[model samples]
Target chain A: MMEQVRVVLDHAGDISPISSEEYLRIGGYQGLKKALEATETIIDTIKASGLRGRGGAGFPTGLKLSFTANTQADQKYIVCNADEGEPGTHKDRIIMVEIPHRLFEGMAIAAVAVGASQGYIYLRAEYPYVATILEQALADARRQGLIGSNIMGSGVDFDIQLFIGAGSYVCGEETALLDSMEGKRGEPRFKPPFPGVQGLWGRPTIINNVETLSNLPAIMVKGPKWFRSMGTERCPGTKLFTLCGNIAHPGVYEFPVGTTIRTLFEEVGGGCPRGKKLMAVQTGGASGNIIPASLLDTPMDIDACAEAGATFGAGDLMFMDEDSCLLDVLENLTEFFEEESCGKCTPCREGNTQLLRLIREFRNGTAQEGDLNLLLELSNVMRGGCLCGLGQSSPNPILSVLRFYPDLFVENSYRKGDLAYA
Target chain B: MTTREEQLCVLEEVAAIAAKWRDRPDMLIPVLHEVQTIAGNCIPKEVAMTVAREMRIPLAQIYSAATFYSFFSLEKRGKVLIRLCRTAPCHVKGTKETLSAFEQALGIKAGETTPDGLFTLEICECIGACDVSPAALVDDTVYGHLTPDKVRELVASLQETEGSR
Candidate 1:
């Protein structure tokens, strides 16, 4: 069946549309106004909506908000996690570029709901233009009385700040993001305190992804039933999939969570770029496993993604067609993890170094018979022992790639040239 | 000692930035970028010390941040700082050719400054001008799609402009 391309864009077909103007026009602040007007309704709405954390873990967003709200602290903070350093994952970048104001409004609304006064968007420095736009939007939001004290005369006060990561991938982990924001190195902190309890200057905080926040307004405005009706029971609402690589049309696709990846590619993204068939689909960016083209009909719903052993992770859907080498993709993603690892824990820091060395060996063809086994073993050690999400998630690519592409291993071995896009 | 006018200039700039973005607190990088573009490449020690006095950000932090990235030039720079790409894509295209051309043109190594201070040459990570294959930045201005002859002429153009100024 043919389907219309869901316009996740701030304003469809408007070239110069600013996210702020377009967002406000599309019943944007109506949610914030509603939240401010009925404080109790905010928590109830999120709980009823069933919106899972799109940042890969799929935790219940309302539950996290409610838990943080219940925590007894002098102050609580809201952080929009935008440190999207994953290779194929440019999804968060789209949200930041198109509707930063919407994210801000969502944060402000969430902040008020949780009795918090301030929010932070920890964006990576790779998004220089997004950073500039966010700064501009923030200033405008402040001037409009949507952010500052007594917003809209509802007496709900809130403000937002942005911090840029030096392109560290691990900072996407909620706790690590909290640490980096506190003026320390961009390494992941231990999580018994959990950002929800002791975050940002040892205060309670709620860290939600940019996409997760964008959904807040919709959930609040249209009600949870409308959101739930789109996706499955556990997974609700239309997700924005940042489609890229050898596909015929490489861009973001906003569709219901349960939409099969094939339908998304065939109908929404206009089928694989050129006539090339799909080789693999990488959901959840670099951390998630790569599904082979044989599984093109695999539904991209949260349950299916989990059964396929990948998380939604900021919803970065990377499609690779035939004629592309998995070894090269692994190498590209590896190089990113190596450079972006914060080096706080031994497993992630040293394990990543060892993994890269081994991956390089496989590419160099200097790999021994047990080289794959050894890589798998190292991944196991890193996955279980790492301090934070950075080290733990590092094994995902190594583990997933070896399982899917055994032929790419034996033929190419290890070679530096394989990493390049030929 | 730095003059009072210099002190007041740093004071007003820091104060203005603090007043504007004190809430955001994350605009510090862009703020510091504009500050360093003033006469010297870095926030001079005196200026750093002054910002420290007003904003409570330490002089050490200011120096540490300025030194962390290659973009923030700490020491006095030559009129032209020729930072060429040294990463994989550029290296694959033979950045050595560019290095050799600069060596012959300036009679100095890639990291050395000419005795006359007209040019300072160095290798850098990718500056995102991969379209140029071998590219360079001269004083924050990008020169893409460069070759050996272009490097030589680029130096010549710089010398000509310096003379005119």
Candidate 2:
């Protein structure tokens, strides 16, 4: 296996996250300087790097920039999606805390590439501490002439400010984030007039994930070929996986894109606390599908994981042992989705509650075998009929369990006594 | 209970905050955040009305936006807000036991505040501290690797801090 690659986490522990001087000393703004020298070719360099978004959706970063650049507008905006609410995903928090200036620099480069003048970091409210660190980092950069009017004397004016989410998980969706920034009930808008065409006060906008933007500076400095050489051909460069749950070690680790479930779990995660036997592994967070031990050899590539009935979303790898009951876990996840569904659409608002009720009945030992079919039908409806990603992906956990551990649902259905599992 | 004069003062404060973003009508969330923070963790009805009037938006819109978010509580919260992680990662690591310990120490359940109004225990999604499973947030400070005893000790420390004040 490849050694732990630090492409995304290069400056995490070496220097204080808020220290502008420390970040600059380690060649922090080199990429932004390079981009400033030749602003027009920056998009081409990014396109050549083959960097997809580090967010759950692996869209090409260069293609997104080109759309906004091509659009004609009196004003435009660049939004950094820092609302990392996906359960089991915390790598963005690590990036925001350890190397915040990297994010600022990346945003600056993106502004220059897309010809945008202003930017915003849409931070999640849960991370108030990280917000302060980021605010301090922005203050330090502004003081040093790294941000604000005519940065680095490159004659390009760009400014960025932080906007906090109001405890809405749906706000992590790009349009929903835009709505939340506009001070409305965080709900997703219709597509086609996508954010690239009309966003953030009806101006052309480009929304990039925090980790995705964090890569821009480095990709510029090391060159695209150097980045392409690190990971698999399809998904280039190292991906940060937040490894946690029922393991010997639980923290964020950066691994190559094609690392197998076995290596990520057994080798790096220390293999499911002693003698427990890794029963299951959940990837991509609550919205991601499951990878049973039978499929432990499946690669973490997006297409490969999709073929295995799972998604490589945000690289949230969670391990579970024999002692943990999948039924209880499903109930916990279902309840979370129901509470966070935003109630804008019928499918997500109603379907999530129905799913939670069904799972609770099963856990209470009063469920009928027919309820399983009902649960399946409802999940399909939500997946197809929901308006946004939150509703569409909310049923992923149940569907993954149904795909992998069918017997767990079968054995629990219509059972009488001795249902004392927690 | 706050006096009529105090309520009017809060409305004035809300109006003042709303004036900064009146031209930028899209800045509704930040404006409510400031009002809630100033109004002791809950968005008072009077303050919401002032914000709506100043922003030229409907009161219903303000209420809908405020109540839509879990972070913006419509009811009054205690001095310290305790957000416990209830995600699967923390659940498997014995979060139920830790939660029970907190419930016992606080003399109330997870969604309720203590009788003295010093603490409010809430079950939240992962706060991104899964590395230390059974992690919790006490007013923005994260405490991880918690045990039942540790929870009691934490409550005692908070109680002591409150007593000295």
Candidate 3:
């Protein structure tokens, strides 16, 4: 019987998200207050907490903050990646709609730690109503002098503005997000002078995801040791997992990292509905791996899932029942990648279209035996040569399905020369 | 097509919106969003030109952003644009049926606008309303937990509001 351990979502539904007074009543800006009091030690405290980015990458949050902090720059900025564009993931929407002040407080703490005087919340255009809610929350925080100049009577001045993205999925990648914020096409940029060193307007900018920033207020108020007390050694603190697809319970659930897939499926999600047998599960969003039901006991931590040849990307668990077809699922995911590829690099731009065509052939039962080898070759090229995460992980669903259920391909395909390649 | 005078009115409105953002090049997307809202859900050629000139941004950059994003439209749309979720969760939960229901109710297929200028049907990647699977966004509002009956009823209600208008 696994249950939700509410850390970031504390007082979620009970508090008025638009009212800073209610947030204060529940100890909202205490973390920002603590952060303002001890500005020099904030980065060290965050490092000790072992908090990682919740936006699928699992990068350490403290290290990212310290990079921008350590860099010498006249103008530093903190950008919150509220562009929650991942398929089957809606936890950030809930967090922003329920506990927006907590998110703002987290950003203020990060700004104080990194010496950034300005911040931006790059909200997605899909969630326009969520933007209105955040606007109200931001207004309330400003009214209390919590976000603007001289927060809590301290000399630290930091304020956040909302910038809405139109409808580009690639903008969820941090570099593309920065490019989009600059009012350009949402295409990713080359790294090495990463956003930590050279970001928005070529200034040192620290971009943290909505979920990652939402954890800061709690960590600062509760101390680093208390934050590290839960979860695994490498992956500390709770994670928000959104379960959907053929499951009885399909909503956001918060649990400590390292919770097994079996517990999330059976005990927490109540497994597939109507006594249907679970055939396969896709952990992470559209780019996540598709594993068979036999591997349900794998822990949902970053290191554990990576060790199991999967990723804990954005913590989205999508289940499929016996009635579902593996090839159809692969087609849907492949089509998504093809549509979302920014076309900046050749591998991602052309590779996704070819992959989609290949998957459709499999779905139509017209795929030849050699098409499997072609599919693998294309996926390898895309994974190895794509510019950003979108193209790199686009082949995950195909590869994972081939790994777990190779019998599906063999059973469904035709002999070579029986069907011509389209 | 709008007359030259009507185009001038739209250009003036766009210039005002661009000025509201201080004509900052970085505020191009926001300015275009407002212009799209005012110009009937799409950025017209004249309006884009006006934005480019007022915002001091290149026309290519404006078009790059407008076409890069799914929300921005180059052609005119209906008064109401229905963006249905076409992602995996919605697909697994029968969004196809809901989509067909919408197409049937509206007498137009996906990506087609009704002749009456009331509704436009299109598919979007995801709007993060998977919990209520089979969701569609009308304007800025999200309507989820949809069946064929719900889809028809929603269309009827929208048509009624338009008829009264």
User: Which candidate's lDDT is highest?
Assistant: 3
**TM-score, candidate 3, first chain:** 0.97
Clashing pairs in 3: none
Q: List model 1 lDDT by residue over A275-341, tens digit each.
A: 8777777767667777787777777777887787655665666676676666666765666567666
Compute each candidate's TM-score over C-alphas. 0.77, 0.96, 0.97
Residues forming the 10-long window of minimal summed lDDT in candidate 1 chain A: A413-422
Off by over 4 Å in 3: A415-422, B1-5, B21-23
Model 3, residue B138: distance off in Å is 0.9
i-RMS of candidate 2: 1.0
Kindly report the docking quality category of candidate 1.
incorrect
Q: Candidate 3: interface RMSD in Å?
A: 0.6
Per-residue C-alpha lDDT of model 3 across residues B83-143, encoded as one tens digit per residue: 9999999899888899999999999999999998778899999899988888999989999
Comparing 1 and 3 on DockQ, the stronger one:
3
Write down the worst ten-residue block by lDDT for model 2 chain A.
A413-422
Q: Is candidate 1 or candidate 2 better by TM-score?
A: 2
Report the lDDT tens digits of candidate 3 across residue range A195-291.
Answer: 9999999999999999999999999999999988888899899999999888998999999999999999999999899999999899999999998
Q: Clashes in model 2: which pairs?
A: A182-B26, A183-B29
Better of 1 and 2 by DockQ: 2
Name the better of 1 and 2 by lDDT.
2
Q: Sort all candidates by lDDT, best to worst.
A: 3, 2, 1
